[model samples]
Every structure is written in C-alpha cells, then in structure tokens.
Target: MSSPRLWLVGCGNMGGAMLRQWVASGVVAPDRIDIVNRGDRDFPGGVRQARDLPDGDLPDMVMLAMKPQQIDDIAARYGERLAGVPVLISILAGVEEAALAKRFRTGAIVRAMPNLPVGIGKGVVGLYSESADAAARDQVAALMTPLGLVEWIDDDALFNVLTAVAGSGPAFLYRFIDALAAAGATLGLPADQAERLAVATVQGSALLAAAADVSPAILADRVASPGGSTREGLNILDREDALKTLLVETIRASVRRNAEMAAAARQSAVGLGRITLFPFVLSLSHRPSSPRTGTRRTALRQAQGERQGGSSSRNRTKRLSWCRNGANSDCLEGAAMVPLYP
Candidate 1:
C-alpha cells in the first residue's frame, strides 16, 4: 500500500523540481523521499531532509540530482554504500553511466538529463541506462512519468545534444523571449509590457502548435495573411534558416563543453601516475556537523587523497560523460584504453 522508498541526494534545482512533481501528482508519497542536501532549499511539503545520510540503511533506489561538478563528492562518500542499490539515476550533465557505475556499484545505472521545466508537468526528461532487465527500466520510467514527457536514448553520445535541446533549451527560449520583447520595445512599447506580451505570444503559439494536427510550417502559412505583417516576420526568420542555423551551433557548443567535463571526470577517476596530491589544510577542525563545508570538503579531500596516493590507482577510476550531444543515446563502453582528456 506504500510507495517504494527513494533517497534523493542533492535536491537543488532539477532534483528539487522532480521531488515537487512526484509529490504533487500523487505518483509518489511525500514520506518516501529522504533528501540529503547541503543547505535547505525548498522541497515539497512533508518530504524529509537530512544533514547526513540516514543512519539505519540505504533505500532501494538513489536518485542523484547534484550538478555534474559535484559527482566526485558523491562518489567518494557514497560509492561504497551504493554497491548494492537496485537502481541509480543521475541527472548530472557530462557524467556517464559507466562513471556512475564505477563510483556506485548499482545493479543498474542510468543517466537522466532533464531541463528546468520539470517543476511543471510539461517538462522533458531523457534517460540512458544499462539496466539488464525490463522491469528495472520500467521502475525508473514510472517515477519520471509524472514529471513530463519521458524519452530514452539508444546512443549515450546523443545525450549532450539532448542536454542542449531539453536541458539548456529552456534558457534559450527565455533568451529568445527577451530578444522578442526588446525588439518590441524598440517599436516604442514599455519594456515591462513588451516582456509580458512577448511571453504570452510564445506560450499561446506553443500551445496552438501542439494542438494542431499540422506541422508548424503549415500552421505558419495559416497565420501569414496575404502581404501581411506575419509574412514579413516569417520572411526574416526564414532567410538562411536563421533560427535553425543558430540552434545548430548553440547545441554544438553545449555538447563540446560537456565532453570537456567528461574528460576531466575521467582523468581524475583513474589512479594514473599523473594524479597529484593537493591536501586540504583547513585551519580549524572541519567536522561533519556543518554539512555545508564539513561534509563536502571531507568527501573532496578524501577523493583527492586517494587519487594522489595511488600509482596505477591514479588511472583506474573510469568515467562516463556525454559525447557530442544529439538524439543518439549511444554509449562508449570499454573506454579504458581511450586516451584521457586533458
């Protein structure tokens, strides 16, 4: 009669949004979440928050929602405990399923990339998992269903592209809104009023496009009157496929950076002789009580120490990161021999 237990680590923006949706839609009960975050951000009412890991035992599943940069801290502190978890889902960008599996030995590991819209039910979520069974994948999908449209990629390499489109796409849309509003202001409307009108137009148009059976290109024809203003605007956007061209590069840049981070995470994972020791020298004793500095720093110092102290250990920590992002959920396994990124 009870919802399955789920432990969430690092519920800031994306994680926090998932928690909000899960509880609001009644897909998961509030009591099921045991959130371990650094500082208190907002969470759905009645969801649990803790300064540290729960004492008794691990939950059946762990959904890691921290930024990709925070993966090292997670792996250092929680990797050993994660060995037996049935499923592990990561929403961090640039991090890969293999890297996650190496860090946390879950029976199945999934990398999930979701955009900010997930706070509302209209968001988009992309999933990549090497789960051995259908049941395991289904279990993960059911939880994400309430948040928004759920998509799984066969090529993990495409995740970088998905991240740009879905994950960073919202920001891009917001920017376009700002551009439209600014252009409207140039025509003498007050900036505040222009902003409101621009946002409303985009929202309504999006809804209209969604409901219409015809493609957006066809819908545009219905809007453009003979020699009318809408046609003029469409001509400008259509010239050189301006919007399409800009978006191609926009996604390309995002995917390129994701690859860079992946390389950094991988380089650190292996205990290669290249690892260097950078010990943490805090002036006073850094205890775990102050979850902010204490817990995180403790984990980082430990990961760094272990990396520096190893010979072959330096290069043995393998990692998974998004390749040039696209629709492909393609994964690059057996990257052991792949040259480490600088």
Candidate 2:
C-alpha cells in the first residue's frame, strides 16, 4: 500500500503519545507526518510540524486528536479543510463516526481510542467504524497493531461504553496502584520505597495474569494458602461481594457518562441544544433501567421538560443481561450506538 500523507491536529498528551509511538516504531518516517496545532508546538525530534493544514492539496489521511469538548471548535475550524480525505481518524472522546462524516466529508472515519501505554508499544486500542469497508478496516487495524492489541468494535454505540472501560479503565487501575502504595506507606513502609514496590508489583502481577494459562480466579486461589495473608485480604473483598458491587457502580458511572457524550455528539450533528442522559428507570427486563419507584416519572418529566425548553433528551433503550453459564462468565461487554441524522 502507498503511504498516505498524514495530517494531525491537537497532538498533545494522548495524541502525542500515539504519534511518538508511530515514529519510534519506524512505522512511518519522521518526514511523512504533518502536525497542525494552534501554535508552533514542539514535537518529537523528527516529523514535520505545520501551523495549519498545509495550504494546498489536502492530506490523504487527517486525524483529530483534540478533546471532545473542543470538538465544536475543531469541527468548525478545520473540518472543511480535511473534507474528502480518504480517511479521518479521531481520538477525541465521545465524538461519533457519523459526527465526523458530517464535519469532514471523508470516505471513512474511524474512532481510535488509545491509552497512555502506547508510548512503549504496550497500549490497547479500541477502534470503531460503521462506514469503512474491508480494506479500509484492515488499514486502520494494521496501523494500530504496532501499538498493541487492537480490536475493531462492530457496533458503533458500544464505542462509548467500551471507551469508558478501556480508555478510562487505565486511570482507574493506576489509581488503584497509587492507593495500594499509599496504604503501604500508611502501614509504616517508607513512601519512596512503597511507591517503587507498588508500581513494580502491579506490573509484575499484570504480566503474570496476562501470561497465565489459567484464569485470574484460579491464579488468586493458587496464591492464597489454606489460611494466609492473601486470604485475609481476599476475605475483606469477597465479603458480600464488596469489590464487585463497588466496581459495578464505578463502571455504571462511566457507561452512563458515555451515553451523555453520545448526546453531546448528536447535538453537534444538528445545531440543536445539548443531549444528556436523563436518569430514568432503565429496567433491562423492560428498558432504560429506571429505578423501581416514582423516580421513573420524575425522570420522564425532566426529559419532557428539556424538550419543551428547546433541548431534547432520549433514553436510548439500554438493556443489560447476565448469563454466567454461557461463554465468558465475568466478562461484560456493551453495545452503544447513536443514530445519525442527515
């Protein structure tokens, strides 16, 4: 395949890390990449950096790496310039593929979600695209392979939820590591020593889990003897399934917010007011998982209220189910898609 001319806007932290990995891995030479930012921003040692979309011909591929909140400015300012590009990849959170199609008349738009670990070629990227064909899909996948395990999400709506899990999941895990270290320090270990051990311990454990042929549950069992220290801590977490409950709410919060983002992206598609997820009684057995009480009526009233006020919110029927006896027991995946208006 011929290497496509690349254009990047807002190559900061998350985006910068992806680009840095691309360059370091020798997937693309320094000179082949072009960066466009607000100012004359400094970049990795190599690669061409431009103040604006290079004046003349459009690039073959244009990617947006700015924040989701900045999508409006990004769409308004640079959208037209990159229109009709063969591929437009967005790393912005919450922005949907349909939104990209409207902003930039691209052949295809792919949402590429990457975490910080991509810098050292140890990241996991979740990709989604409803419009791209087989070849186009392969191209995107190939580009991401060097970074880490790349999976293409077949359903678009699931993007946000998956993004919530994979994209935001790292920060949650990192915080766990930090909390563990701090707890160690609180128990009398030196802070500096505690931090090092905590980080290394997590890294090693993660590697072991990833490499192990057995499941994590089995692995945990192997670590805890008939009556040991690991078992003591395990008891605390296992009591009434405390950890699972805590994580359920944690994941629920992220998924709920992702729906909010879908609303945001849809709002941008049309010049309508913001879209938000009304906390409605979302009963999976029914739909919208609303609480069992009078809260459902209140949420519905608020949704109606928004429409009357010129903004509209819809409870895109969300249904969740569990079948432990099926394929993967503890594994929970979601499907989230927002219909696009022409």
Best by TM-score: 2
Report the alpha-carbon TM-score of model 1 versus the true structure.
Answer: 0.77
Query: How accurate locally, in lDDT, is each candidate?
Result: 0.68, 0.67
Tens-digit per-residue lDDT, 1-342, candidate 2: 555567888888887888888878777666778897777666677677766777877766777887666677777887777777887888877666766676677888888888788888888899998888888788788778878879888766567557767888888898988999999999999999999999999999989998999998999899998789999999998998888766665665455445445445655344322332223322212223322223223223322332334333222321112212221111112222222111
C-alpha displacement of 319 in model 2, angstroms? 17
Q: Could you tell me how far off, in angstroms, the CA of residue 154 lies in candidate 2 after the best superposition?
A: 1.6
Cα TM-score per model: 0.77, 0.79
Model 1: ten consecutive residues of lowest lDDT: 319-328
